[model samples]
Target: MAYYISSFISPFGMILINILDGGEEPALKLTTEVLTGHVAVYHGDQIWRVEANPDWSLGETAQALSDLAFEAEIPEELRTLGIAALQNCVSDLYRRQPFVTA
Candidate 1:
């Protein structure tokens, strides 16, 4: 169970992605540019069978996780573990991209 988030930052904004490593689930993405942001969670392998536009908020990251829990009818504890795992992954990524101003 691993999480991967890669970011592409630009002068305008950034594109954040969440991709699975050892799973079959499609990746999740949050993109921003100027005044608008988009959140999408993909479903399916051969093709995208489902799509979602979760509320645009940083908290939506966790909210999306909870939503998945409900949708998949998984146990309460799995949501907790999943969110924690994602947080750790983000922290690791941030470490590699430490902030700097120019």
Candidate 2:
């Protein structure tokens, strides 16, 4: 199962974000309503979107997005959106993880 999060726009188009929950196989059905057990990104309007496996860490997703942020395929005008999404997810993980800073 998974949770539908927010979506971000890129030069290519909208990049939908989904948070995977429980251990259920994805159905790949698209909808505007947020639900569980799926990580489907509606790409009817755009060709690219960041997606994570059921076992992948959001940190990994953030890293993947970070890496994609610099790809030649990504337009300069919208590069920051992907990077910002990655940073936002990373920042959320940072605050959620247990850590001690000096």
Candidate 3:
């Protein structure tokens, strides 16, 4: 069971972030749709796996994109997308914690 957090179109493709099985961290999945052959994945705040399609995973490109986000070096137009995705994921996880109070 994965909880979808956010998604956005980028140079790479349609990037989506989700929490896998109620996990605390987010998993990033890159998809190019029917237009191209790009695909990748991001997990554990790192590049968990990446490879060519139809195999699913996040590679170096996705890692670089996230790195730029963390370093605040992503282009102005794309800035905040990744950061917001991460923030949203964490916020949702925190809210789900048993000890959390209203």
Q: Name the candidate that leads on lDDT.
A: 3
Candidate 2 versus truth, CA RMSD in Å, comes to: 12.2
lDDT of 3 by residue, 1-102 (tens): 334445543332235554333556554432233344444344445542333343332233344445545544223333344456644543454466535321
Residue by residue across 1-102, what tens digits does model 2's lDDT show? 223334442222123443322325221212212233222332223433444444544454445545544642534434544355446645654576545111
Report the C-alpha displacement of residue 54, candidate 2, in angstroms.
2.2
Deviation (Å) of 96 in candidate 2: 4.3
Residue range with the least summed lDDT across 10 consecutive positions in model 1 = 43-52
Q: Which stretches of candidate 3 lie over 4 Å from their true place?
A: 1-68, 99-102
Evaluated at residue 28, the lDDT of candidate 1 is 43
lDDT of each prediction vs. the true structure? 0.40, 0.38, 0.42
Q: How far is 40's C-alpha from truth in model 3 (Å)?
A: 11
In model 1, the runs with Cα more than 4 Å from the true position are: 1-73, 100-102
- lDDT for residue 83 in candidate 1, whole number 0-100: 46
Of 1 and 3, the candidate ranking higher by lDDT: 3
lDDT for 82 (candidate 1)? 41
Error of 3 at 88 (Å): 1.1
Q: Sorted on TM-score, highest at the top, how do the candidates line up? A: 2, 1, 3
